[model samples]
Target: MWNSQSIVQQQQRLAHVLAIVQDLKALSMLPLLTNLDLIQEIQTISTATRPFIPSPTNGLSLSTELF
Candidate 1:
C-alpha cells in the first residue's frame, strides 16, 4: 500500500501526464493509432520494470478455497 505522500505524488504525476495527452489530442485526428501507440509505449516502460505477465489458466485456479 502506498503512503499518503507517495499516492499524492503519483496523482500529481498522472495529472501532468493527462495534461500532456490532452495537448496531444489537438495535434491529430487519426483516433486509433494515437492511443494504441501511447499504450504500447507505456507497456514498454512497464516491461522494463516487471516481468511479462503469465498466461491465465482458463478461469481456473489450483486453490479451491480461500484461506
Candidate 2:
C-alpha cells in the first residue's frame, strides 16, 4: 500500500519544511534591513539645522570689517 500519502508519511512535515525554508529566506534579508536602518539613523543624526536669523543690514556693512 505505497500510496502518495503513505510515502510522504505526513503532509504536516512537508508543510513544516516549507515554512522553515521561508523563514530562512527572510533571514537572508537581515543584513539589508540593518543597512537601511543604519543609513536612516546616520542621515537623521548628521542633519544640520541652521536657525533663521536675519542679517543686520541697518547701517552695518562688510566694508567696516576692513577698517
Candidate 3:
C-alpha cells in the first residue's frame, strides 16, 4: 500500500532518528551527573520516535539496547 513518495519520506525520517540516536549514544558516554538531564531527554526522544520506525527489530536494536 505504500507509494514511492511515502517510502522516501519514511526513509528520510528513519535517517534522522538514527542520527539522533547516534548523538545520544555519544552523549551517554559523558559523565552521568553532568548529562543526566540530557540522558533523560534522549530516552524520551527515543521512546517517542520508536513508533515511527518501520522495522524495530533490525534498525533499532542498538538504540533499544542502549536506552
Model 2 residue pairs with clashes: none
Segments of candidate 1 deviating more than 4 angstroms = 29-67
| Predicted candidate 1 versus true structure: per-residue lDDT over 1-67, tens digit per residue | 8899999999999999999999888557456557668657656765666543534865322332233
RMSD (CA, Å), each prediction: 11.5, 19.8, 13.5
Best by TM-score: 3
Which TM-score value belongs to model 1?
Answer: 0.40
Using lDDT, rank the candidates from best to worst: 3, 1, 2
How many backbone overlaps does candidate 1 show?
Answer: 0
For each candidate, the alpha-carbon lDDT, in order, equals 0.65, 0.58, 0.68
The TM-scores of all predictions, comma-separated, are 0.40, 0.40, 0.45
Q: Write the per-residue lDDT of candidate 3 for residues 1-67, one digit (tens) a residue.
A: 9999999999999999999999999878666645557656565677775533335566433144433
Worst 10 residues of 3 by lDDT: 58-67
* Candidate 1: pairs in clash: none
- Residue pairs with backbone overlap in model 3: none
Clashing residue pairs in all predictions, respectively, total 0, 0, 0
Worst ten in a row by lDDT for model 2: 58-67
